[model samples]
Target: MIAIVDCNSFYVSCERLFKPHLNGKPVGVMSNNDGCVIALSNELKALGVKMGTPAHYLKEQVARGEITLFSSNYELYGDISTRVQAVLEEFSAGIDPYSIDECWVNFDGFAPGQLEDHARELRRQVKQYTGIPVSIGVAPTRTLAKVANRASKKIEGFGGVCVLYPDSPQTKGLLQRFELGDVWGVGRRLAEKLGNMGINTAWDLRNQNAKEIRRRFSVTLERTVLELQETPAIEMIGMDFARERIMTSRSFGRLTNDKGEIREAIRQHAQRSAEKLRKQGSLCRAVLVFLRTNPHRQDLAQHNPSMIIELNNPTDDSREIVAAAIQVLERLHAPNKRYMNGGVMLMDICERGTEQLSLLGTQQSDAERQRSEKLMGVMDELNQKMGRGTVRIGTPSAGAAWHLRCAHRSPRYTTRWEEIPPVRL
Candidate 1:
C-alpha cells in the first residue's frame, strides 16, 4: 500500500512548534513583502480568513491580538520539514517527498491490517519528534491516498489516520460524497468540465471508461480515472526532476524607479537562476528580464516591461547569465516608472552536455570554457561550504532598497545558531 502524510497547516504549525501557546489560536503566515495570507491555521480558516487575503485587511485584528501573523520563515520551515521526513523514514521503507509538508511513505512489507496502526504510530512519532501534527491516508493508489489524507484531516473520527482498500465499503461511501474537484490533480477547472459530462463525484468519474476519458480530455484525466479505481497510474515521483525553465523573482522592499536598483535585483535573480541551472546540470540559451510597477498602486503611472536576450551559446555560468539579464534590463527598464519587482528567467534549457555549440567567435573558446567552469565550480563550492554569497560577482549591499520586506519574520530557530529558542532558568 502507498500512504501520504501531510502536515496540518504546515507554516502555522511550524511557527506554533516554537510558540506552544499559539496552538489553538488564529494564525497565518504572510507571503513576500507581507503581501497576503499564504498559510492559515484551522482557527484562522474558521474565521473566514482564506488564503491570499491581503494582510492589510487584518491589521485591526493583528493589533488587537485576535490573529497573529508572521512573515514566511522558509529556513525554519525547511528544517522542520526535514525533521518530520526523518521521523517518517524510520516508519516506512522509503519516502517520496510531495512537497515541503507532504511525503508519500512506502509500506511494501507491512500487512494490510497493520497499516492503520503503523500509520497512527508514525504520526505520533512525527509529532513527538518535531512537534508537528500530520495526517496520513493509506490506500492502493496515490490518488486514493490523497483522498484518504484529506479525510484524515477533515474527519476527526479517524484520529489523523485513514486506510482504504479498493473494494471496501468505506472507500465507496467517501468517493460517493467527495466532490470531483477535490480529487487529486482535478482542480476546479477540470472539475467543471467533468461536471458538464455528468462526472460530479469521484465514484462517477471512476465508473467512466479510462480510454474514453483520455479521448475526451487528456491522458492525465485517464490516469486519474484509473487511480480512482485502485489502480496505480501515477509514479511516486513526477515525470522528471530537472526543470525545463528556471525563474527567480521577488518584490522589492520599497518601490523605486532607480535604474541601479532595478539592475541589482535583476542581477541577483540572474545569479540565483544560474545557480539553479548548474545544480540541475542544465544550460540555458536565453535570459528573460521583466520589470513591473505595483499594480495595486492606482495613483501612480505604471509601466511593466520585459525583454529576452539570447546568449551566444547555452551556458550555466553566472557571469554570462547575469550579463544577459543586465542587457535585457538596459532595453526593458523605463524612465520615471516606480518599479516594485523584477525577475530573471532562463529559457530554452537542456541537459548540460547535450547541446551543439556554435562555431562563431562569440562562443567561449576551449581554454575560456575550462576557466569559466573551474571558476563557477569553486564559487559554488565556497558558497556551499562557508555560506551563500560567500563568493559573488560584484559588491553586494546589505541595506539595498530592492531587498525583501519581511518585518514579521520569526527567527531561523533551527538553522541559525544565534536564533535558537531560549530556555527558562
Candidate 2:
C-alpha cells in the first residue's frame, strides 16, 4: 500500500501558524512581486476570490477591508515544510517527498487494515508538531492515493483521511462519482478528449480498454488506467532530488535597462545555482545566461537574448561558474533594450568526483580547486550562521532598482532570532 499526504492551504496555513488571530478569516498569499494570489484560505475561496487573481484588480476589496493579503515569505514556508517532512520521516523509511507540501510513503510494513489508523496518527502528529493541517489518502497505487486524498478533503464526514482498497465496493462507488479530470495526471486537454468519448467519470476511464487507450492517446494514459484499476503503474523515482539542469530566475521588482544591475542579478543567480550544485555533489560543464524585457511594457523597446558557455572542465566552484555566466550575460545584453529580468542556468551536470579534466593548460589545478572549495565552504558557513548574503562574492548592490517587491512579508519567525515571536513581560 501507499499513502499520500498533502498540507491544506499550505502558505495561508503557515501564515496562520504564527498569527492565530487570522484563523477563520479570508486571507490570500501573494506570489513574488506581490503580483497575484498563489494561495488562499477556505474563507477566501468561498468569497469567490479566484486563484491567480492579480493584486491590482482587488484594490477596491482590499481598501474596503473585505480581504486580507500577505506577501510570499518563502523562508518561513520552507522552514515549516522541513519540520513537517521531519515529522513524517518518523513514520516510514520508504518516503518520497513529492513537493514542498506533499509526500508519498510506501506502507509495505504496515498491515492493510491498520492503514487508516496510521494515517490518522500521522495527521495528529503533524498538527501537534508543526501546526499545519494535512489530509492523507491510502490505496494500492499512487494514483489512487491522490484520488483518495482529494476525497478525504472534499467528501463530508471523511475527517481528513480516506483509503481505497483494491477490489472494494467503496472504491468503485467513489470512482464512479469522481470526475475524470480530478484523477491524477489528467489535464484539461485529456479530459476533453476523454469526455468526447463519453468517459466523464474516473470509473469510465478505468473501465476503458487499456491497450486501446495507449494506442489512441499515450502509454501514460494507459498507465493511468491500470492504476485506476488498482494496479500500481508508477514507482517512486529519485524523490526530492536535483534535476539534470538547475535554473533560478525571477522577474525584477521593476523594469530597468541598466547593464550593471543586470550583471548583478545574473551573478546572484549563478552563485545560487553553484551552491545548489555543490549541495547535490555535482559539477556543471556549461553555464547559460538569459535576459528579457517586460512584455507588458509595450512602450519600451523589447529584447530577449540568451547565450551558453561550455567549459573545458566541469566544476562546482561558484567563482568559475560566475565568470562564465558573466561572459554570457555580456553577449546576451544589448544596449538600448529595457531589461526586466535575468537568470543563470547550469547544465551538463555530472557527479563531482567523475569530472574528466582536459590534459591542457586551461584546466584548474589541484591547489586552485582546494582553495576554491575552502573559500566557498567558509562563505556558506558564515551565511548559514548570519543569514544569506552575509558573505557573497560581490554583494548585491544596495537599493538596486531590480530588488523584489515584498511589501507585506511576515516576520521570519522560524529562521531568524530577531523575528521570533516576543514574550509578554
CA lDDT of each prediction against the hidden true structure:
0.90, 0.89
Badly placed stretches (over 4 Å) of model 1 are 196-198, 236-240, 296-299, 358-368, 385-387
* Alpha-carbon deviation at 301 in model 1, angstroms: 3.5
Model 2, which residues run further than 4 Å from truth? 240-242, 361-364, 381-387
Root-mean-square deviation of each candidate, in angstroms?
Answer: 2.6, 2.0
- Per-residue error for 258 in candidate 2, Å, reads 2.7
Residue lDDT tens for model 2, 240-333: 4667899989988888878899889988989899988888889999998899898888988888888889986788888889999998887888
Scored against the true structure, residue 261 in model 2 reaches a CA lDDT of: 90
Candidate 1's residue-wise lDDT over 219-264, tens digit each?
9999999999999899964424899899999989999988887788
Residue 247 displacement in candidate 2 (angstroms): 1.5
Candidate 1 TM-score versus the reference: 0.91
Give the TM-score of each candidate.
0.91, 0.94
